[model samples]
Target: MATTINEIIRDSLELIKAEHLNLTPDNYAKVFCKVAKQKGVIVEDCQKVDKYTKKLDPNIVTDMKRFNIGNIDELLAFLVAKLNRANEGDALKMVNTLATLTKRVLQAITLLHDTKATSLANASLERLDFHQNLQSIDLVKEKWFDFISNYDDSYLKKLDAFGHVTKDDLEVMVRDLIKILSKDDSTELYKTLVPLIIASLSPSIASGMNDELASISNELRNSPDALGTPALQQEIKHLISKRIDLDKAEVQKKVAALDKILDEINKKILELIQSSNFSHEQVKVIKKDLQSINFQQDSFETVQVKLLNIASSLESETRSLSEKMISNQETITKLQNRISKLESALLVAKQEVKEDYLTHVATKRALANEMNRVEDAFMRYKIDYTLCFIDIDHFKMVNDTYGHEAGDVILSTVGKILRKYIRQVDFVGRYGGEEFLVILPSTELAQAIHFADKIRAIVEQFKFLYKNERINVTVSCGVSQRSQQKSKDETLSAADGFLYKAKEAGRNQVMPVL
Candidate 1:
């Protein structure tokens, strides 16, 4: 019988939970490493942070137990709590690294899933007579509802939730799968494995192809077009691991060694000419003769013993070149890894300046980024843009009445409302709790007021329901345009001042009076 993909996912999740009874950062990493090793995924010391496990605080384990990072529903709550007291980067890394390691666990599950399918298919064939097997194989095949209800696609989202996965990670994962499945001879499973492994490797090949990799890619492409055999997966690991080197230094050294050999012949010729007490013309003739005894296919060495000297030099250079090429390949491999590290570091930096985790709008850092662009436009073209500083009226009441989770829902909903209603050219970002910023380009003061008023009304009318409790939400906006402000800060201050005025006058209103 075909098992639902969710059953596999649930089992996979349970397996992780079972691996370690306590799911703190330290225990999580330890369990992850163990699971990966058991599943045939190789981990270099450079890729792990096991040594840091000793440094974890005792309090974190206790706190994590209360929050229960194991439960998906409580995950955000745990993160929100951690972010308040922990180093921001450390908190994010704890989440991101856990997600990344869990991907390895999922890859192992995929391999196990493949192995199970293979065993079942083989069993079905052997259990039946040949003609009966041909007709009854539909039992092995999947059904329509199996396709409809299966949740295999959630694995991709689950993997991407906390970390930025790369092509190299995918290739390594697929390679492990291929190694484990190498013994599976079932033609049915071979068809399944070929495409999955190929798909895993496709992104790596497509994204990072050089001269040598292109040839391998063509071979992989050709294999799928043909039998789509199990052997295709077998060869993919070898193809991806191939590296080439053409060492110019080795070539130059070889040429220099040959030159030294030729130079020795001239030295000996000069000595012979001097010892023989030859005339000046005879010395010139000897020089010409030695030069003529060149290292060429058509030439012959008159000194029979010199061939050994020249041959020895040639052999030495060949050995040196071979050694140099090996060294170069190793160096290139390390360089590629270093480049991946640098790219990953760059990704970390980019991740810092992104949408608000709680609200899903532009974070404060992102707001500053957008402001810089808006400033650039205003300076260069003298273009005008409006900035509206918004504060949710009586927002503290929502938190007081409905709880923080409901408040979070209201915040996120308001962000979505402002983000959705704004022009694409405009910008909307969450400034802080209960505060938002919106920028409208080329808009007059009246239009800015009208737009802010419209958003205020939308938020007021829209209902936010959390845990069977309904709450009314409204926002007060203070509007300012860039036409008169001297700088970005001044424009922001003007909007902020008006926002304060609006709040002072009464909540739930737009402050259009400059």
Candidate 2:
């Protein structure tokens, strides 16, 4: 007698347990089929599926194998998806063909030079533009067919008035006429506008941009036609942006210097007030008024005006003390000399704040400021950026074997290398000892990685000479994109993480393995 279904299931479970296999459905099914076959009972379902699969198209069979479709349900879903995708491809092709047809028809219609023909062409072009996708292709086709059916040939008669003029000749004549009109309009407009623009720029700001402005002015006057090209327009825009950034940087430097000067002057006044024995009530009142000025809360102009008034009062009061304080004349002269020296020192301090003393590149503080600025641009304008975190390999060993002086040389050389390779807009800074951060504005991850690798290769090939001893050096770099991270800090962390990974995977390489 044939094995009963209950007996087959019982034996399948026993076999699974005996073999120490997991009691999964697939395992149970295989065991059950094996036991049934031993008892002379054929499982017809497996046979049916195999037979059906053999009848499918070879390409479909290959696709099933490629996708690992093991059962009928999955196979059916895959086939349905494949069919849907094919239908979409066909629909896209049809839409593209329709668009091309409509564009060609419009081009042919525009050559007739009739007002009605031009209007019809423009309307059809607008409709085609509106229906740019497969979903609206049917409506576009209907409108295009209607336009083609109603198109009149009477417009061609106007062309016959120009005796023996071929269609090609008419086309050339129309194109030449349009070109002349466009050139004259653009040239006259530029001529009238360029002088006014140049005149409006402040002499102080425009002094540095004289060459750029002159180049542009000459272009407008001599080669106005070239300005119509996209390349020339982009060059002009770049020059404008460069000039704006330069002016902004100069203004910021001046403001920072002024701020430092004001602070120093306030400190000197306070010191003089504390040390002075003011016998006059007016001198005491002037000191009290000077102390009342709020540097932090008040605007720069307001602070300047108040300080000026206080200085005038102090000047008048001090005149009376000149005879009484004659013995302190040397001290006063020394203080004046000290103030001058302090001014110079303050300027140097400001420079040091932005520049690293050892590396001569930007300092970490400056890098942070740049990162914040770049982050603002990213957040506000959707402009993307990338960071490269670089660490010199075996730097500690270099310092140990050589000396701290040699290490400094290495750091300085690396900084110079980084600065040399980067663009004007890109920033490279000494993040800390033996490490650097490069901020690449408007850069992509892949491009940044490539850049980092190039830097790595350059450093590896460079020779470090200290005390006439050659030292071999290499660097590991990590790169990350701002767009890939949720925050600027995260982006920096990611770059650092990649840098660590690069160091771990045998230094002197760029991270993310690519």
Candidate 3:
């Protein structure tokens, strides 16, 4: 039987699920663009687009459009083909627009399925009027299902050919969805389907199926049956017959590397021993150096035992490290939840407590402590992502015109929203009056800037209703990811400069210098 479109989509989804990696929107966008182009829907060829453009998935129309995914697919393919054909520097410029589209699509997709409305989701739906007549689109839903069932097997094969799906890969897939959905932002189809694609990549998102292939190495090493009596073992000939080829290429490479290291160490030792200043003191230093080398040799020898002792050590190390990373991730998550709760509590307390100087100082102290806790957590990861500071554009006017109470409300509202929008790994603090700082762990400047834009939009659109008068607010933001060490003053000064620039250019924008 020829596969229906729904079956094709379903099988493709299954193939995606079979992999042990997270399927990000970027991956789907790339694959979708490839498939759409192959089907002659997209104008450009997949080979021509840059990785980010491919992730964007520009302009492909489908019989069943979901979240302009088809449009994104077509556009990305066209851009990719165009870029490759032209081989121009403009490819870099394409990234900003692609990234913006990606954010819009992702935010939109998240909202369509969300029963509970989040600010991002609400904004997406609002932009497209996605919620209006949303519950009454049965034909659209049916067509989408049919499209998935009859999706081509060749497309799945193409996806497999793309090979390993990394975080970057996943982003491409999402961008593709965005492109398709962008065509008819009025439709909520892409918004519905994008999440479903993400769902398929769940296994990869979980414990990682990549580890499964090597897990047998550990089981064989630990199995008592492998070491049982010969007579008993003789009954199961297959036990000894099984000679699973474990990839020793990496081990061999390591061995070669170690040998080179040893050679260098030996040369150094010989030089010390033959030194003109050779004496009891020199001899002692040589012995210490030799002991250090021996200690390393001992460690390597211990590791080599498994490789040489009919049991590979790869399993033990991979499992151990994976577990540690997972635990650390969980710890970060818990800490984030705790911090969010604390922020909410503090905000509530601000409303309840008297706005006296002593109270304000005490509250500020508490907020600072929370920020410190977030910094400590980042320290444990030994990552450079926690670098952050805040700038509130010339806010003396708010204090002067709006009265201190209104200024307080504005500050509090901004602080609350910042805390809410940021992920668990991110931190926000009241650095000083009309100034707040936010630290983002594991984020690059580009990512931080994108997030800042999203938050800025939220603040701009927020309805500040106080005593029946409507209040509108705007902010200038400067975001950067710290990759090198600089004095605190210097770093803050640079960020402040960016904020000033943004204000100069026009407030309500995020400027990031990489």
Candidate 4:
């Protein structure tokens, strides 16, 4: 009843095929063991491999299971392969760590802001880059070692002159320098400002404060340095307060004098009514109202109301009195109309200065104001913004070929598009001819670049028509974030530089190509 070895072998081959397993040695041995056991033959267990595998690390045992490593030879090969991969990974990690360290070192050197340090950092960067491209970590390490060993830190001593060269120290130094300069400037400013303040005083007000004004002016001119002391500053503030009080008193005095003049006129009118026999209901009403008027109130509104009521009563009285009153009323109305016209003209002039006539966006003056506002916000709150410098491509050519009118239309259209797309918090302005500045508050550089690209595409696709002729138009944009630069002007200049790059690369594109 026992199976022969050849029959067991034949049965193992058939079972392997039936089980849809590969005919490898491990599969054959396992199947052969199974077949022999079924035929009542004693067979060796293939599970003996597990005893050795269990003695290995759990991770290795898992790998053996995964890779089907049944024998010692297979296990050895897998272990070797795993070891090779781990070695490669560790080498990569070491190289990355070195690169990161080198980068950080270069950044620190750059922050020193010294010419020599910058030169050394640049050279090191070049060498690091060369080694990194070659993937030779040993060479990189050697180069770094040589840089450190041969590096002369003598130049660093110069930074000690700046007192530790920290941010706080630099800020303190700047403050001290500004204080000194401001003190010098203040002497001259006080000399000029005090005289101007004195000259602006009205004659009535000036009479009362003349002695104080003359003394302050003489002190400011002759001993301007005295203003540096706190005592002198307090004295000047006291003088200013006295001048304000004098002005208020002068205003009240003038109001009282006008009230007296009105009272005299009312008495004269009442006398004329009584003496001329103009006895009517109008006369009674006017008499009653004038008598009831309280001139002692000393308030302008009360006087004006009383005057208006008397004028209303006088107008209805008689033709002769009415004619004279109408003449006076016409004169006053003309003066008021003239004043209103002047105010309206002033307002229009101011608006014209702040807004461009053709584009309806902010003028360069307004843009400057907005820039200052944005910068103040940035410096005070660390709230960042971005500047997008935009220029119409081939603008000069458009002007030359299609006339300046067409160019104006293009400029106006571009400005409108820019203004339309921006958020309410953003600003768009005509920086100059064919140039616009868009300020994106709280925007990152990447977001600004995206916004600029969107605008560029919109401008390029727009159908610009002048005199029924289709004209091609496009724009180049340069964008920069405020925090990335040293100052507002530098940020603007950077945006302009990027714009130049965009134009040089090709028109109708955003610089930085993000």
TM-score of each: 0.34, 0.45, 0.31, 0.38
Give the per-residue lDDT of model 1 (tens digit) for 264-353: 644643343344333333434434544554443111222323434333333343333333433355643553465356446544544545
State the weakest 10-residue window (summed lDDT) of model 2. Answer: 197-206
Residues 105-157 of candidate 4: C-alpha lDDT, one tens digit per residue: 98788776567567667766777776654445545555556666666756546
Using lDDT as the measure, the top candidate is 2
Give the poorly placed runs of model 3, Cα more than 4 Å off.
1-381, 386-394, 487-489
Question: Candidate 1, which segments miss by more than 4 Å at Cα?
Answer: 1-349
The local distance difference test score of model 2 is 0.73
- Residue 286 lDDT (model 1): 35
- The weakest ten consecutive residues by lDDT in model 4 span 197-206
lDDT of each: 0.60, 0.73, 0.50, 0.72
Among the numbered candidates, top TM-score falls to: 2
lDDT of 3: 0.50
Which regions of candidate 4 fall more than 4 Å away from where they truly are?
Answer: 1-329
Better of 1 and 3 by lDDT: 1
Segments of candidate 2 deviating more than 4 angstroms: 1-276, 279-324, 327-330
